[model samples]
Target: MKASPTRVHHAPARALLAATLLSLSAGCTGASPDAEARPQASCAYVIEYDSRTYLGREETDVPVGESLGSATRPACDDTPGDGDDGEGRALMTAFAVKGVDPAVAIAVAEDPGAYRLVVADTVTELPPELRKVTDGS
Candidate 1:
């Protein structure tokens, strides 16, 4: 026996309704609105491939979309203050970069590389003075 058009439509509608109910039920499990909406912290770091040297680092709480141009800020403090691990603070690495825009980090990452900073997302070019560190000199 074949399913009637009405039966098919009803089946699909019921499936959709079930899915919607499941989602609604999940949301009703009781998490605070703020907790659910809050962005988690992330880690950010820079890789240099050229003769770039940083004396220090500093962080500015700029809006996520602001163009982070060539402004040299002091490096973060030796005592860990932000984020996890407490490997000490290092400005850019101090904050949770979870919600940070990629363009912003990309702009910030370019300050050190004369040739390139990150190539293909997996490998970042080593700093020029860091040749000995990579055996690429």
Candidate 2:
């Protein structure tokens, strides 16, 4: 008797093709893999006084009756107060920056007076007083 030829299996090949097609279709959805990792601009407030600026990540972080200048360290320096006491609470400005990198935002927050210029172009809208702080007025 002649030896029978082995039959090739098509199931695994079909499954692999299906998986490849599925993955290709999923990738065609126009969503970037790093979209979630990208940095998004958010509402950040800045307090300007004596030609210096302090950044507050949240509005509540820098209330209108606290002083950020009293803190000896930068991390604790975002009180956002208001008064004529000549501290960092002289002026409070709220603004949003669009398309700003998270690292740049942090740099601005750490030292607004120095890093404000880095994101000057990305500032969305600003009050007249904020203009002074950005413009070094």
Candidate 3:
């Protein structure tokens, strides 16, 4: 039997369409290969405490279109006081980081020295003040 010209023309188109559909289906099952390694979007906040007292706080948002950036600020309420004078008030520092996780963020905000970097699971000391050195864009 002789193949029709129309059938031959449609054969290639059908094969291309099938291939495209297959690739798209595989992608829908789960995230891309690089998705696991990519950084997630998150916001960070700086919670300042003075001798275990809630002094003040600052929110630092990642710039639009960026995934991560350093955030720092000096204490806003630096009033002179002993804060709490219990038998054990182990927290005295004024600066702490409170990153994205809800529970952890709340704990950090309430307690002293709970710094979290939203991009990773590691915690470190409070970041240095990122002072504004220039006023130009």
Candidate 4:
């Protein structure tokens, strides 16, 4: 039996199409190269009254090492009878700062107030070593 000429040509076309698709799909799976190259912007942060150990990033251009002066504290809803007035509570306050110089971070940490250094882009919690420093332990 003789093979059709059209069938031979179709085999190569199908292989080429599959290879192109596989390459395109692989490119989409991982972090973009430019994402690593770009620097993220730093923002000012105020710690909530509830979680005094970690700093939450705020959308402000306040320079590092400067006080976040006059920022409103996060409401303490979980505390009993704390009320919306936010008084009569022990009131924890800290600034979790990231993407700043080490010296600046230390200075901020050394402040008598509560402040913790968090890993960049992951403001979930303060690292143990930083917690010790901030806590003055």
> Which lDDT tens digits does candidate 3 get at residues 34-69?
754543432223332221212122323221122222
Q: What TM-score would candidate 1 get against the native?
A: 0.23
For model 2, residues 13-88, the per-residue Cα lDDT tens digits are 9999999999999876646767545434332444443344434432222112222232121222322232222223
- Estimated TM-score per prediction? 0.23, 0.20, 0.22, 0.22
Enumerate residue pairs that collide in model 3.
none
Model 4 C-alpha lDDT per residue in residues 1-137, reported as the tens digit of each score: 99886765678889999999999998865477675344333333433322233343322322235544322333443334323333322333224343443322322332354444432333345455445444532
Regions of model 1 farther than 4 Å from truth: 1-9, 20-30, 36-38, 42-119, 122-137
Could you tell which candidate, 1 or 2, scores higher by lDDT? 2
Report per-prediction Cα RMSD to one decimal: 13.8, 17.3, 18.2, 15.8
- Poorest stretch of ten by lDDT in candidate 1: 111-120
Q: Which of the two candidates, 1 or 3, achieves a greater lDDT against the reference? A: 1
Q: Which rank order by lDDT, best down to worst?
A: 4, 2, 1, 3
- Give candidate 3's root-mean-square deviation (CA, Å): 18.2
Clashes of each: 6, 0, 0, 2
The CA lDDT at 13 in model 4 is: 87
> Which candidate leads in lDDT?
4
